[model samples]
Target: MRREFAILAILGSLLLAGCSQLERLTLIRPSAQHRGYTQIAPRYDFSGKHGRDTGDAAMLLAAGSMFFQRGQLDEAEEQARKALKAQPGSGDANTLLGLIADARGDAAGAGLLFRSVADAAPANGVYANNYGAWLCANGRAAESLDWFDRAMADPAYPTPVRALANAGDCARKAGQPVRAEASWRAALALDATHPQALAGMAAMAFAQGEYLEARAFVERWLAVAPDEPAALQLAMQVEEKRGDNVAASRYRSRLQAISPGPTTAPRTQ
Candidate 1:
C-alpha cells in the first residue's frame, strides 16, 4: 500500500524531438486520473543527411512510443534501440528505453538511463520529475526531493502540481511531515481534487490520531478516486478508528472487491 502511494505512479511525459514544427504527443500510457503527459511533437527538417537521420530517429521513436503505450515491450524496445542507432544520444529514445526497463523491473538500469537523460537535459522538467520519481520509489526518498524541486523550478514545466504532490509523498517517506504537509497543501491549492495530496493529508492525520480529519481527507480522496485500492484501504482504517463499523465494512467490501489480497496501511498511532 505504501508503495502504491509513491510518486512514480506519475509516469513518463512526452519527449521532444527536432527544433521545428512542434505539437503535443503522449509518450506513455495513461494511468489513474492525472497521469496523462504531453510534449512537443517531432517535425524534423530534412535539409541534410544529419537532418534526415534525425527525422528517421524521430519516426522510430514515435512508433516506439505507440508500441509502449500498447504494452508491447519487446517491440517497443526494438524500435527504441533502432531510434538510438539512427540518432545516437537521442534523449527521447533513452527515455523510452528507461521506461521499458522500469516496466521490466530493472530499476537500477532504468535509474541510470533516466539519470543520464536528466543530466543531459538539465532544463527539462519532465526528465527531472522522472528521475525524482524513480529515486523516491527506489528508497532514496530524501535525495529525490531536490529533483522534484528542479522540476518545479522549470517555468516551462506544464504541471508543477505533479511535482508538488510527488514531493509531498517523498517528504513523508523521508520523515519530514512538515515539508510533506506543505507540499501537499501547495498541490491542493493548484488542483483542489488532487488525490495524492488528499491521501497524504489523510495518512498524516490518521497517524496523528486525528480520525475526524483523516476521515474528511479520505472522503475527498475517495470521491475523486473511487476505485483506488489504497484509498479504499485507508478509508477502511479511518472508519475503524472512528468506530464506524458499518462504514469500515463498506470500505473493506469495496477494497476486497477490487483487490482480494490484504493490503496493510501505513503505520498509525
Candidate 2:
C-alpha cells in the first residue's frame, strides 16, 4: 500500500517551470463527439464482452464523462458506479471511476483502479499512458517509464507523442537525463511544435550552456504557447545567459504580468 499522496499543484505554481505539462486524464467516449462535447485525442475504444447491458454501460459512461468534464464530480461518480454495476468488468467504467478518485485526491485508489484496467488490456495504449502518468505523479517515476514505453509500443496509439513527452518528464525526474533527452527528441520528431518537448529541450540546452540553442527552442515554444509561464521564464533565463539583460527584463515583465503575486527572480542555471 502506498502512503497518502499529495494533490497536484495548479498550473500556475512556480515549479511548473521545471517540468513539462502533465496531461490531465480525460474520458474519451466515442459518442462524445456527436454529443457536442469536445473530443480529445488518444481515442480509447473500450470493447469487450462485459455483459448483456453493454449498451447501457456505454451510455452511462458517456454521461459520466460529460459530468466529469463539467466539474460535477459527484454526479460523475454516481454515473460511473452505475455503469460499473451494469457491466461489472467494464474497463471504461473502471477508468472513469479512477478519474473520479483522482479528482477526489485518492491517488492510491486511483492508481490501483488505473493499473487494473491497464493490466486487463495490455494493448490499450491509452490506459497504459494514463496509468503511467498516475505513477509519475505519485512518486513512482522510475516505474512509470515502462508503462509509457508500453503505450508507445502500440502502433494504433493515436498520440504516441504524448506518451513520449510524458516519458521524458518521468525519466528526468528519475535522474536519467540521457533517457529523458531521447524521449523528448522522439516526441519532437513526431510533432515539431509540441510545447512540452520544446520546453524540455530548451531547459536541457540552457542547463548545458548552449544559450543559442536554448533561445531557439524557447522561441519555438513561446510561438505555440505565448502565455505559458514556464516558456516565458526560460526565455528570460536564455536572454540573461546571452548577456541580453534588456530582452531578459522584457520577458520578466511579461511573466510578472501574467503570474500571480510578487514574482521572485528565477535562479541562474
Candidate 3:
C-alpha cells in the first residue's frame, strides 16, 4: 500500500505539466471560477508571410502550439519537429518539442531538450524554470535548486511564484523541511489554496507520520477538486493510516475504476 501511494504521487506530479508555484495557483480555481476573475475573447493576428505560407517554420510552430493546447501530442510533436528542421536551435521549436516529449512520458528527453535551450540561452528564465522543474521531477533535487535560483534571479521571468514553488519542492526533496515549509508558506501568501503547495504540505505531513494533518491538507484540496485522482489516493492513504480498511479499500476501488490500466506509480514519501 505504501508503494502504491508513492507511485500515485509521482504519477500525479508528472501528469500536472506546469508544476510550478504559479501554475499550481492557477489550478486552485477551476475554469468555472475564471468567470469571476477575467474573461477575454480569443484574438489572432494574421498579417505576415508566416500567415500566408502554411509550411513556414513560424506557422508550423504556431500550429504545433495549437495542437499541443488541444492535447494532440502526436500532431504537436510532428509539427514541432518540422519547425526545428527548418530552423535548427530555435528556442520556441525546442521548447515545443520538449513539451511534446514530456506529454509522451519521456522526461529524460524533455530534460535534455530543455537543457540544450538553457545552455544556449543562460539568461532565458523560461528555459531555466522548465529545466529546473524537469530535474526536480526526475529526482535531481539538488541540481534543480540551482536552476530555480537562476530563474528567480531573472527579472524578466513573469512567474516568480512558479520559481519559488519549484525551489521549495526541491528543498523538500533534499530534506530541508524548514526551508521547504517557508517556501510553501510564501507560495500560499501569493495565492491561497495553491494545489501544489497544499499537496506538498500534505506530502510532508505524511512523511513525518502526521496522518491527521496530512488528511486535513488533502481534505481541503478535495474540497476544491473532489475528483482529483491524487487527492482521492491520498485520502485512501489517510484512511489506511487511521485503520479504516473498508474506507481505504473503497478509495482504492474508485482509483482503479478511474485509471485501471498499467499506469505509472505515484510519488514517494
| Structural similarity to truth (TM-score) of each candidate | 0.77, 0.80, 0.66
Per-residue lDDT of model 1, residues 1-269, tens digit only: 00000112232111223211111111222111112244433343222333323446656666666666667889778878877898688666787888788777677898899899889878777778878877877789899899999989977677888789888988888999999999999999999898778888888999888999999998998898898777788889888878999999899889888888776764431
- Cα lDDT, model 3, residue 214: 84
- Model 1: C-alpha RMSD to truth? 9.5
- The digit string of per-residue lDDT tens for model 2 on 1-269 reads 11110112223322122223223221223222222222342233333223224547656666666666567888778777877787677766787787777677677898899899889878777778778988887788899999999989977666788789888878888889999999999999999998878888888888889999999999998998898877888899789889999999899899989986655544322
Q: Rank the candidates by TM-score, best first.
A: 2, 1, 3
Who wins the TM-score comparison?
2
Give the range of the ten consecutive residues with the poorest summed lDDT in model 3.
1-10
Q: Would you list the C-alpha lDDT of every candidate in the order shown?
A: 0.70, 0.71, 0.64
Off by over 4 Å in 2: 1-55, 265-269
**Pairs of residues clashing in candidate 1:** 23-41
Candidate 3 Cα outliers beyond 4 Å, as residue runs: 1-58, 69-78, 81-89, 102-109, 239-268
lDDT of 3 by residue, 241-266 (tens): 88998988877777788888633333
- For residue 257, what is the lDDT in candidate 3? 82
